[model samples]
Structure formats: C-alpha cells, structure tokens
Target: MSNEQPPSEQPPPDTASDRLLADMLGLFNRYERETAAARASQGDTNPYDLAPYEDVHGVTNEYEAARDSDDPRALDQFLDNLADGFHLEDVRALRMATAAVQAAMGRIALAARERGMSPDRIAAETGYTASRITQFIREEKQRRAAGDQ
Candidate 1:
C-alpha cells in the first residue's frame, strides 16, 4: 500500500556478526585448501606435520605418541588437540579417521599378545589382519626400547 519497495525487491544483506563469522570461516577454508594442495603436491597424506603442533602447549611429544600409539584413543586425542588448538572443523573429521586406524592397530597388537595367539590369529579377531604383527610388535618394541620414557 505504501511506496516502499516490496520484500522481494530488497537486496540481500549481511549483518555485522554474519560478516565477521564469514570472514573467519573463509580464513580457515583457505588454510585447509592450501594444506590439501601441499599434501597433494607431495604425493602423500601423512598428516604428521611436527611444525604446526610445535609452540602450541608443548604438546609435541603427546602428538608424536598419539601418531605411534597404535591406540584409537591416542589418535582421537591428537585430533581433538589439533582441532581445539586451531579451531578447525575439518580437522575434527581427520582426527576421527586417524584415531580409528590407530586404535585398530593397537587392538591388532593386543590380539597378537593374547594366549598363544599368532599375529594372524590376533588380526582375525581384531579385524585388522595385518598378517605381520611381528613388524608391529618389533616397531613397538624398538620404540619402547629407545626409552620412550
């Protein structure tokens, strides 16, 4: 009834908080894209960069332990730390995936330890079937032998 433009005629708009959040999200998205490109260019997906974790709460050893723990919990904790430290949502998913694999590996090693259980036996029960539990055991041993304390 008035001369005012209809709602449909109004231009799309962004609020102050909306713009702030969008800017923040964009910054993180750019980082993820860059990191992904870096990994792809290297032909690897290791996800074990010791640089970013450095200088952040002195968690260097913790992160390394998580990587090598072969324990699911370790991987989860590692990813959580990374996400919390960097405030990135994508890393949350990466953390879950990493934790699952490591946990399965840990179970495999544990299965190999059960009574008279060969590495194969352990793998069968644990669903990993690494077929070379010896290698896992050996690596674990070496890691322990090196005074991981």
Candidate 2:
C-alpha cells in the first residue's frame, strides 16, 4: 500500500511560526533603521566607525537569510564567512554591542516586572524562561545598587 497522504489530508500551514518569523524580521529591520537614524544624527560618518556597523548588519542579514533556508550548512556558511570577512577587533566591538543590548534588555525586563507583569508573561513575550526573567530583574536591582554606591 502507498504511504503518501492525499492532497485533502495535507497538514495545515504553520501560521503561528510564520507570524513569529515575520515579527522577528520586522524587529531586525526596525532596529537597523533606528540605529542608522541615530548614527546619522550623531554625524558618525567616519569609515572606521562605519565598518563595524556594516559588519554587524551583514552578520544579522546573513543570519536572517540562513534562518529562512532549509540547508543544514547555513550555520557553517555563516561561520566561514564571518571568519573570512571579520577581524578580532570587529568581534570585540560586536561583544561590546551585545553587552549593551543585554544591559538594556535587563533594564526593560526589570521595569516590566516592577510594573506588575508576571514573569511568565514577560518570558512569553521575550522567548526567555520565567526564571531567567526573574534573574534579570534581580541582576538589574543589584546593578542599580552598585551604581548608587
């Protein structure tokens, strides 16, 4: 007997996954635009300063492209390209940017928790666990306390 299912029995499209992917792409695009505007306002036109921005954006664009693909070598390709195109200095700058983003995220999570949002609710929105959300809030409090000292 044939194992193939009829066309009427085909699985439904994963609208939830589609929506989530769309939202992620939108967020990335918006962040890119906002940062570009902020850089333009600051007159940050130096080629040296701009290289890192371009490199970071390239990485993100590559990531998004790879993510939407089905090839198993997407990650390998990204790594190979990164190694070929980026320097240690670029990676260090990316680390700094990552740290800044994490700090901002922690602060935002803390504010949301303080405003009575449940940890689970925050987690749902952020793709983090409830425990991680609570941890961020606690770390943010500690950071503020240390800053005040």
Candidate 3:
C-alpha cells in the first residue's frame, strides 16, 4: 500500500482560506457563548428565548445552525431576527453581538488592506459590495482616529 495518508488523517495545511475558516468558527463560538451569557445575565430563564421564535421547541437547533455556519450572514440574519422585537435583553444582545462581529470583520478588512488588497477584492471575498467595503474601511479609520484623540 502507498504511504500517502488519508485526508482525514492528514493535518490541514496552514493556508489563508483555512485561517479564515478557523477565524469564522472562533467568532461563531464566541457569539454563542456571549449570547448565552447575556441571556443568563438578563435573567432569562429559558435558554432558547433568544431563538427568535414564539415556539421555543427545537429552535435551539435552528439557532445553533445559524450561529455555527460557515456563512457569516447566517449569524447576521439570526441577530436581525432577534432585534426585530421589543425585548430589551434581545436588543442588547443583538447590539453586542453585532458590534463584536463587525469589529472582527473590520480588523480582517484592514489586514487585507494592509496586504494591498483593493476594496473590490476584499468585497469579493467577503460577499459585500465594493462600496460597502470602502465604507467599512472608512468607518474603521475614523474609529481609530477618534480613539487617538
């Protein structure tokens, strides 16, 4: 038999794509943990209360799917749903999660910019429009500038 190892047995190569995927998963895990903590701190008795549904049954699975996906928009959409109502805890959690995820995306975009990636390129990779990518970079720069003052 050949000495070649199977894909499952082999270690993943340290490619940019792999790094991005790892970062995504890390961010998702943080989102889940933080959201749960926020719920607990707000005295939410039900763990599935943040699931964005009236019927809490089986919604944890749907929430997990939304939070643990490779697509960042899944989490964004989930947060959107959460923020759609007038619940104070849900709004606060959504705001916190949105800020955290946006900060991470900003850092990634800035790193790409530092590496000479154009807005169009970053947008293509991030699934955002070039104009929006440019706007995000501008906003991040302003935030840093404000922090320097």
Ten residues in a row with the worst lDDT in model 3? 50-59
lDDT of 3 by residue, 2-98 (tens): 9989867967659999979877987998998898789878986454454454444444565778889999899888767655744887657767876
23-52 in candidate 2: lDDT tens per residue? 798799898888877886887543234453
Q: Which is the leading candidate under lDDT?
A: 2
| lDDT against true structure, model 2 | 0.78
Q: Give lDDT for model 1.
A: 0.65
Ranking, lDDT, top scorer first? 2, 3, 1
Please identify model 1 stretches exceeding 4 Å from their true place: 1-97, 100-115
Indicate the residue-level lDDT of 68 in model 1: 91
- Number of clashing residue pairs in every model? 1, 0, 0
Model 2 Cα shift for residue 108 (angstroms): 2.5
RMSD of each: 17.1, 20.0, 16.9
- Over 50-142, each residue of candidate 1 has an lDDT whose tens digit, in order, gives 444344334655676888997879889887756666745545655876698675664448545755677777666545655566667666666
Q: Which ten residues in a row have the lowest lDDT in candidate 1?
A: 45-54
